[model samples]
Target: MARIYTPAQFGGYAAIVSCAAVIASVSSLRLDSAIPVVPADDVSAISRLALILPVIVAPLALGAVALLPEEINQLKSSFADGAWLAIAIVAIMQGVTAVTNSLCTRRGDFVLAAFVKVVQPAAFAGIAWLLVRDLSVALATSWIVALLVGTRAFRGLGLVSGWRDSIDACRRAWRYPVFFAPVSLLDTLTQALPLLAIVSIFGTAGGGNYSQVQRLIGAPLMLVGLAVGQVFLKHAGDLIRASTPLTPLFLRVFRNLVILACLTVVVIVFVGDWALAVFLGHGWRTDTMFLILVILPVVFRTIVSPMSSVFLLYGRIGLVALWQVSYFVVTALAVFLGRSGASLDYLLATLVCSEFMMYLTYFLLAYFLVRRVDRYQLGLK
Candidate 1:
């Protein structure tokens, strides 16, 4: 799909998709994280809380966009047509999917959770192949349909229970979303804001290249991180509930991730350019320097990914949220400093620095949190 489409077209699609993702993330209120931490009895309620927000917020957001069509157009000229409608649909779908995925995770039904993860990109690739001529619509429609299908799969699992339980559940878990929603929003913004800035300053083509590089380097690391993180979250939550000492578990996971990160860095440093040329094709090929620049941040992310669950496990959402805000601020500042031209070197450098800072902060925070947990368990405090 990336190869078939020009950078401008791909960039436009990427911008809209990023915007929809930001909206969805905000509407979700981070209840997905809460699902695993909250009591099993409150799972139904949290799921309901997840559903209610999107239902209420998506429409209001769509209404705002509809009313301020000119403002939206100014923000992204690609959204000049009825593209905003597609964005709205995607946002709503994403919100619903987040809730459903969380419910599946809480229920320990990783099969369903994993299926939901696979369905979106698989559907997008298939749909994009068929609609090769119109990449924007293809991408939007793919997400809309995939998310809807994934959400529907949870129906048979009895996630909602009933209208009465839905209301009661929301009441019980109200605090989780209220506290975590802003944290989730800031985290989502940390990701989306940089892409949005790149698109705004460098146009869709620059955004396209940026998005592609992220897809190439970030995707592999994210896949491994997500799988490990999910298992870590589930296991850690179980241990906490069982009153088990988490110091050993935390140390084991940390050591394993460090080993994995070392191996990943070595592989990318040696063969990254060849791998990129072979997999992404000659058109996507770049000099080894650029490839190195791209992989550096991904390396940081690789190390940070496994430890991300620690923040959620230890009730340090505020610290994580503050770090996300700092990330966005630094990224935006870097973009402003380099806005003179759309230099890939400049953008990559900025991104690499920002990602390193954010990941490093996370590592330090996780270390302190783990030490605190260890001390408490040993009666040192």
Candidate 2:
């Protein structure tokens, strides 16, 4: 019998995403706080290299990494020499850590995914302590260890499939990037634009603060959203392919997401600063209002988050690209122009504004697309 979704599964998924969020948030706290202290410019450079890497490196690295077949030796070797080799190494390891997280997530095992993700930051901290004196090595080792731990986690979960086969599956999933790339770019810009903008004003420290907020709110959003979104996407795809209707499923998930977002906002408003103080320390923590504002986009995201699944379900890459680009452009411009003053409040407000724009834009587009699809199916188009 197929495994039924249960409270245990929910526990597992939540545990996984929460854990991942903790690790991510804590690590950001450390990195943001650590960057200013490194004495040597070269070490700082190396550390900064580690930091600036994924902006350019992640996708290219992901592409190369995903293209390989499931040979362990081959995958390892390829990862060693790939572009942004260091970042690639980190990505590989992090990918492993997230494997079980992703699997459980796809299986509607939210708790498990959350539980698995929590280990990531702790693992990094442990490694960072070991190499704390060498900033570059510490930075590199943090990710490396995280990946090692991730691999072990995947192994423990029995999700460690052959690299060759994993790559093969990814190869088939290649069509996704056509749509995923642009959306991903827009996403990176939305989250990372503040850092870029900060270069003109307060330099790295300002960028670091912005990055921290982005990491704090954005990372959790992705993790939590990913957990639910994966399950929803898979179900929606299956239903679409089976010629079964999907509106009920979409609506139910959408409502649940909205309810979740409301609760999240309340928590962020009430305890956000206290939580940040405990987790990120006072040095890296910002205003509660700023955090609250940063979280607004998540509400919009909850509504339109599943739209890409619709795009992928119908293989509507062109429409997805167009809709996503429109959202991206509008949001980027709004955020860029809005970055005035050094206050986290202004920064977050801008970020939230951009997110809201994208949310509304994507939601409307997805709604219409779904409606059009449904009408066409009923011979009413």
Candidate 3:
């Protein structure tokens, strides 16, 4: 076997990222969420922020890349050089992480996978520091690094064979994600709109406060969700690829999520307030509000994220898009109506209600997809 990536290597990387994130978080002074407010404040900053959306859309907008039939090969050549250069310059740490995780998954090296998970936060911490100074660079760099690293690591672990293999794997992976991009964009808009709305209706401080609440609480929830999704993706991908039954697997994942949701509810009910108070101080410790507005959506979203892997396995991209569209519409309308009251409580309540409804829709859709897969696998249809 090629030299294994020791846990220490993973731990070291994680530490660096963690440190960076800590610095970034502090530097942000809880202003990361205030980003959405930029366009509303200064026209120049708004233009800068607007420019980023296209950049964000570029990589995933491969369909546009494909449309240049006469220049297909040229586009590929150009994109190859540009993408690699961008990733190298901006996302080296994240790239390392992605590659490592892919390798671990392919090798069935759960130990390495576990290690990779821990290291990512350390990298994030590092990226976080950069973010404090420049939000755009930090955001772009973090994602590029993470994706490239995952891509490269998959090759190292023999999940993929080489650069071309890695590209193909990403292409396949991107298929479903890309299909859902429109609705995904909508969801992004809805999720991010609150901060924007607050800034428009209120100001930077208002946007910043709500944004901070989302970030502080959202971070841990996302981390746990990340670990869960990664583990599930690896396992489920292997099973589906092997042609093993997936209904049982789907049900199992659902059960675990339900358990997690229950536990989350308990925590939110009890220690959530104390934890928030300790971490964010009294002004930010609206855990009750956060629990209602943020935590539930996070939990619901986490549950769907893993299960979405199954849809990818089945190539049900359109269905996934449909679900996200539903979610976006609901969330947007809720936010819009909530803003009318001009109170934080009203906004928080709207967010919570929208997410709860969205989660129900996600669950139902997920159930339908799984059932369809079962019939297809059984030759019942």
Candidate 4:
């Protein structure tokens, strides 16, 4: 898009997408998180709840987006025509996609999940190129991902029917909306924070640059981490069912992620500028220090975000939510400190340190949660 649209336009697209994403996080009422923990026998009910809630709740989430200040819709108006409508549609579509993606992963359909991860983005880019003057990145990507994944996300979900199943589904997983909804909401907001912060503090051009890095670098790594997480969530259930020790499994996953994390940090620190120059071209600023400060936290995030599911697996949703709230506050504090008569690099630096610590706090919590669950399951407690 750099070759076709200005940085400001790309940033506008990102802003709208990020706004919708926060709503999308809870559009399913976070029922999808129940998939991994719910018994295989009750999988149908859980899937039903996960899928159906989005339909009922998506409009509400979109309504929340629709209430966003009118100023948001004014961005790049000629290119981003119908920006508010785009947010509403993307919010609903992405919510459905998130639910279905989890459903597919529950079925061990990682291939399709991985395929959608890659292909949906590719499709969006292609669609955007064709619709360049229209600036369709946000809308195009949401449509493509929803269409590609919803087909299989609904597989085997037709087993039950009628209002009976719907009510039964609600009865079965009422804990999700009550418990994990806030966690998902806080998490998506935290994930979207830096981009929104950049846009707000540093302006649209900075947001554009940051979103590109995320799309090209941070998101792919996170998706791979999430793919691994899906497998972890699935297998974590099996180990629990069989009364197996989770510590060994947890450690093995942690070690592997550390290796991947190290490799990514090294690549970004050494050749980040060169890579950005090649991929995004010289038109965009690709400062080395800025990249390090902004991206370092993402490297640590890749290691922990996927594996943090241990808390949920152990029925510690409340604990995880508490941690997420703390994480968001400290991160926002970092941004606030950085913005108060401090340079952008400083904002990113303090943000990095604070977030790195928060991620460590989460990783340690997950580690101990596994040990506790293992002891209880194996009768060591």
* Model 1 agreement with the true structure over 1-381: per-residue lDDT tens digits: 656777777777778888788778867666656767776676666666677678678767667755775545455465547567777878888888877767666667778777777887777778777755665566667767667766654554354456576567666666556767776777676677767877877777777767777776777777777777777788888887776777788778778877877787677778877876776664554567776676677777766767677777777777777877787788777667766555767877877787888788888888788788878877989
TM-score of each: 0.88, 0.63, 0.62, 0.91
Give residue 283's lDDT in candidate 2 (0 to 100): 45
Whole-structure CA lDDT of model 4: 0.75
Q: Report the lDDT tens digits of candidate 3 across residue range 281-339.
A: 44443557555565676777776666666665566667767777777778778878998
CA-lDDT, candidates in order: 0.72, 0.51, 0.51, 0.75
- Per-residue lDDT of 199 in model 4: 77
lDDT of 2 by residue, 176-237 (tens): 33445555445544544444444334444444454555556666766667667767765776
Question: Which portions of model 3 show Cα errors greater than 4 Å?
Answer: 1-117, 123-180, 379-381
* Candidate 3 positional error at 169, Å: 8.6
RMSD of 4: 2.7
Give model 3's TM-score versus the native structure. Answer: 0.62
Segments in model 4 whose C-alpha atoms lie over 4 Å from true places: 68-80, 376-381
Worst 10 residues of 1 by lDDT: 152-161
Q: lDDT winner among the candidates? A: 4
